[model samples]
Target chain A: MAGKDDDVKVLGVVVSPFAIRVRIALNIKGVSYEYVEEDIFNKSELLLTSNPVHKKVPVLIHGGKPISESLVIVQYVDEVWAAAPSVLPADPYDRAVARFWAAYVDNNVSTVLYTVLAMAMSPKLFDEQLLMFPGMAGVLFAATEEERAAKAEETLAALAQLEKAFAECAGGKAFFGGDSIGYVDLALGSNLHWFEALRRLFGVALLDAGKTPLLAAWAKRFVEAEAAKGVVPDAGVAVELGKKLQARAAAASTAA
Target chain B: MAGKDDDVKVLGVVVSPFAIRVRIALNIKGVSYEYVEEDIFNKSELLLTSNPVHKKVPVLIHGGKPISESLVIVQYVDEVWAAAPSVLPADPYDRAVARFWAAYVDNNVSTVLYTVLAMAMSPKLFDEQLLMFPGMAGVLFAATEEERAAKAEETLAALAQLEKAFAECAGGKAFFGGDSIGYVDLALGSNLHWFEALRRLFGVALLDAGKTPLLAAWAKRFVEAEAAKGVVPDAGVAVELGKKLQARAAAASTAA
Candidate 1:
């Protein structure tokens, strides 16, 4: 239960990995908050007012003040709830390494997912509107299955890099932060369901055991972790959603 | 005056704003270190060894441990120094706000500069290679003066958003972190010279007094700050460099 003064609310969408990251961080910290699922298309006034700059979800409204961006929110959670079980590592160097990997995951791995997911989630917008925004078009648009496959290869390459990063950061431990689920784990793990969904949709094995053995094992442990309970979506649901969106996009394209 | 155990070295290029960020942060903290300017075209083994993943600079090597990425290095500086003159805000919410804006500058603002700069700095790479990287192409490849002008308008708009952010964060103070320079200041201020060069090269006033008055004033003050003495470059040198690069690119195109 949230206290009167320490009220926390999360403006998010169920399928968003970014939103899921905030939930996982809050869940790990054991900080209770009200979750308000947003219609990303027709965003709420609160979401708009809260995150005016980005106007996107996973906004953590703590004590009436809104903090947008999932990574920023997770760090905010770590700082505000400064007790045991810290999300980031305690040492300065370790902390920097965690931040580096977290960012790398966002820039390299997450962008690929967003490209495909953006198409799946908002096919009409992907087809019609994204053309206007060239920068976003590069990020969110994949014209063909060929392009998607190429992007998938990039994702695999990124995962391989993360595999080495995990070996270095984890150092024969369970997770990137070592012995416990930490910032890097949360950053990459939140997208595990989507990674699975991508595999189901396009036959792209992002976390292939053959390629990234450590990361593949880490993924399994991460999804099974107590903090991930109810926070991470089931892969099947994500796949079904992807299929539905794909069908809609095909119909829209045909009409156009 | 560096001690044996606490040796610090920065592998960077003079023109890089990202590298300059590390210098500014280190200079402010009064940390004495070696500056190894890397030839980005023919990157040294040391630079490659230090930051094998990205292999780009502003790689801060502390006591033989290497940390890549400018923002990450700055944070590491703050954490390790742990003095009164902190780069990041001590308050959790304020820190979150600062980090959000810093990232906003990197994602929204620095990107435009990088696009223009990449073309100016590496004309051969731009002409020969960048076509294959479509994602980078959208960000870096602007064929005409028209596209560059459009990007300039986008930069001006970003500056306007940042002007409001400064008002909120500074609350009538000198810098984004308050009276003293902080994280957001270093993040954005590091690019002041490059911004000037962009203006000189394209006749686009990014920090137009008419549009973003507060930011224009902030930029002036930031450049004059004591910590920025030798860290920030002279706009004349950057402008000259841009001109030279432009000429070479034009000559290369004509010959082709």
Candidate 2:
């Protein structure tokens, strides 16, 4: 924790998609700032003071004022740097759709893909140490194979909604928010790397070419062009972390 | 369904708080618009086309483009009519907090208040007909009185978060957004009427002075000042509708 002499600074963790969202927006807007990495287990005083309520990552400190929540930070970046490629659309109606899809990404796409299966199948791990993420734990209590299978179907349904949204809203465009990778793109794109890693680890087939063609294609473009251009954290490192966690969950289950 | 000749038109149902949010924003911005009520039981073709993904109401049609989601519409109205008293704050950080609070109103205040507890406490009626509201039915299956009590306590906890938010963000202001009712006000204030009705019908003291004095005062101010001033649907009518539905839910529970 130090004085806010820096013009712009981001307080975040590496593995978090939410933090990555801020990083992507700041990069897209071409705003230069200092990046301070935080150990999520031991959150810094700066993060705590800046975001007392949430007490989480992706707090963008600009000219001494801190803005919390990833999407909010993205919108702040968009508004403050209005000249930079117009992250949100100029038209009011298009802006609404952009906002809607961005929210959809947050609520449906990212949350469901990352959190739901873990919460369903290996909830005990979450119950032990996931106090900060209250909602993510104890949702389904799917202990049995049949129960987990049913919960997996629900995750598919969630992804299916996103696929439908992509097809309907995008309407053959390069990005959901149109030609540029704007708000919706960044919101969902931050998690694409993790999702892909999960798909490889768990064989979930969330972005299965047969089921979600449009989304699969979008994911391909997002990873190859948008995310690989940098700012997104290493996918391999995250997946390794996830594997270790899954192994622990499995070990916990067997011991029980 | 008519063509896009109308300057502004809102496709919404009166009983919906989301619809009431758009109504309040448009009124605050001094924009005149035609209102079309949609039957929730049987949605119109226009509603389907306008909000294809959600198939929900409060879709604002300006010129030819239709903007879905109530908060999104409110933002659109705020952006387009930039001259009219900035619904969101002028400062970027303040704007982010406002946006975050507005979303909190949606995700926590409204959903946890009306749907989550009812769906958790009562199950049969939702099983019969609440297909569109997938999340509202059969969650937790808290059929026992003790379970219901626990869930109710959780609801109060959620409300307490909002109370904390109000106190921290408002900082002695009448509304969360500022002196006048703005984005956060409309977002949370739209449901104040419904909460009041629930308090009366169910005898639950949600806005008790002892626990949530700021929110209690805020609710009173919102109802008497912002909501009762013509744009919001009559609270009495909404309460009556809610009563009838509650009666049905009671009946369904007994039958089950």
Instruction: Indicate which candidate wins on lDDT.
Output: 1
DockQ of candidate 1 compared with the true complex: 0.47
Provide all candidates' interface root-mean-square deviations: 5.1, 7.1
lDDT of 1 at A173: 98
Displacement of the residue B103 alpha carbon in candidate 1, Å: 0.6
TM-score of chain A of 1: 0.85
| Per-residue alpha-carbon lDDT of candidate 1 for residues A45-124, written as tens digits (9 for 90 to 100) | 99989998878878999999999889999998998888748999999899999999998888777643343434545555
Error of 1 at B246 (Å): 5.0
For each candidate in the order shown, give its overall lDDT on alpha carbons.
0.77, 0.68
Weakest ten-residue segment in model 1 chain B by summed lDDT: B131-140
List candidate 1 segments past 4 Å from native.
A1-5, A112-141, A241-256, B1-5, B112-141, B244-256
Model 2 C-alpha lDDT per residue in residues A66-152, reported as the tens digit of each score = 888788888988888777777787877678878888876665556522343234344553443221221111112234546445445
